[model samples]
Target chain A: MSIDPGMLLAIAMMSAVTYFTRLAGFLLASRLSLRGRARAAIDAIPPAVLFALIAPVVLTHGWPETLAAAAAGIAALRLPLLGVIAIGIAAVVILRALF
Target chain B: MTVQSEYQSSTADEIRQGLADIAPVLVAMVPIGLLFGAICTTKGWAASDVWLMSTLVFSGGAEFAAIGLWKWPIPYLALFVSTALVSARHILMGVSLAPKMHAFKGWRLWAAAWFMTDEAWALGERRARRQTITVAYWFFMAVPVHLVWVASTVTGSMVGPMLGDPAAIGLDFAFTALFIGLIAGFWKGATTAWVLVASGGASALVALTIGEPWNVLAGAAAGIVAAWFTATEPDEPESSSPEGHLL
Candidate 1:
């Protein structure tokens, strides 16, 4: 249950780096104006970063996961957020059971 | 500024609203947090270490990456670099949100930065673009997720043996589902199609070939590039231009 000083220090380092990243944007934005292409890039970050996370999970897992994600994506278009997630999870479970 | 004080009265409502707004994602987070704690425990990590990491690091991707890379001697420098890279996305999240969050100052601003996470950032971005939001809203949205996450991780670490396999019941899909829904929430018209395709395609390609965090960076890079071109359409007026659109 006890952690060594090294591990604690290492964890501290991780937290520091993460906090730095979080703060960097705000600091940078204060100093510099984000316009034109720079603004576009920053704007693109949300969906892009999110998709980047999602894409690999879908592709690597193959059809079952793909179908499930697709169901989620499609449901997300119309259903409530919780409903969409429910559909996606249900799809995975149902598909897993069926095949 | 005087404006900050005007917001002071509404803080309670904003926090409550923020908590309600993020409620959907919280459902999915429970299993993931528990799964994370269970994984750490299985890896021989102390329960305290699991809680400490979740509370301090507060990043699912980075913490998972760290545990995946865990071994004797800890590989301190390598672990730091990898986790940092995996979490590098936070920089973009902060940048994307900074404009909307400009009104927040002092401790409020610092706390917002500390509480920032991909889910909260996504939700905040949607709200900020649509309407003005308060610092309280931001904190409420972000902090509760952290609290629930930490609690679930602790629960998983302590009683991991009883929970059985998270994936067996398809609870693992909850993470992906939540992201899918959140991405949908960020949808911004037709142009988003190509941007998402490019992001997803590049990410999948890099993931299949190189693996780990690089795919995340590559996807973000590709998305930004693709969006730049798409936003620069000849017909669109400069004033109406899609500068900050997710596409």
Candidate 2:
């Protein structure tokens, strides 16, 4: 099948945008100085951003996802990383089977 | 200068050790990458398109958002904007990692940034917290994940439909599981708990209402706000930018 040149252009643009953001850190850090609260905010970012991403999925996806996310979140607190993932995936599979 | 030379002169064993460190994350990424490929085919995207996006964009969240918004007429402006917004997190990721990578120079530094993913950044941060991370370690850790990701995309786009509905087998949850595992590593203290609740709540609210990538942005903003309001004893922050290290 023939490829759409427009779509190809879109993909290229998307890639460029993504790369710019990835490279932005080093570029910005040189020009700007972050100290005190600003630095604290950056430190706080990863977990907060991750939570934001996961929350919508769990809240909107119904009980199976919620229950599984709960199991995973709880397991994450106590178990090893891989074990957390295992229990989460297992919970989802089993929940789907039962419900 | 010495550290730069040391990392630059890293032995093969160090590189291989880097690969070993990221092995588990790579295994988890398999299902998600394949799902992305399958989703691309389902959306009527060309195989070339899938290959280009996966190899170039290399972000599951952005690609997924772009595909979700794709239409027949093709909303080029909207697609570009939303994908950028979804990937905005990488900007912060870049900042968090820049200190450790200050020792790198030229193409080596650029390559490290190019391969930076949420998983890679988190793993790199964990390593940097414990010990210095070298270019060799970063390369080995990142390159294998990138290769596996691209290959998985190609395989899924071609063979994904044959596997039937991925959702049926709970394979769709892999991305969620992946994020959860990564977040688990970042959970630091009560501050983390407050930030997570604030961010997650904001994200869920935005998702239910606006229903797009804005949720992440809003959630992040809310979390930052919460961080500002929450008080804790004065302590040295984990890591800081190389204000002095930058040249």
lDDT of each: 0.81, 0.77
What is the i-RMS of every prediction? 2.5, 2.5
* Predicted complexes: DockQ each: 0.63, 0.58
Q: Which candidate leads in TM-score? A: 1
Candidate 1 local lDDT, A1-99, one digit each (tens): 688777788788888888888888876764444566666666788899989998987777778898999999999989977898899999999988877
lDDT of 1 at B117: 85
Off by over 4 Å in 1: B1-9, B232-247
lDDT for position A68 in model 1: 94
What tens-digit string does per-residue lDDT give for candidate 2 at B72-135?
8888899889888998988877776676675578888788888888788878776665556678
Q: List CA RMSD, all candidates.
A: 3.6, 3.3
Question: Whole-model lDDT for model 2 versus the true structure?
Answer: 0.77
Pairs of residues clashing in candidate 1: none
**How far out, in Å, is residue B197 in model 2?**
0.8
Task: State the TM-score, rounded to 2 decimals, of chain A in model 1.
Answer: 0.85
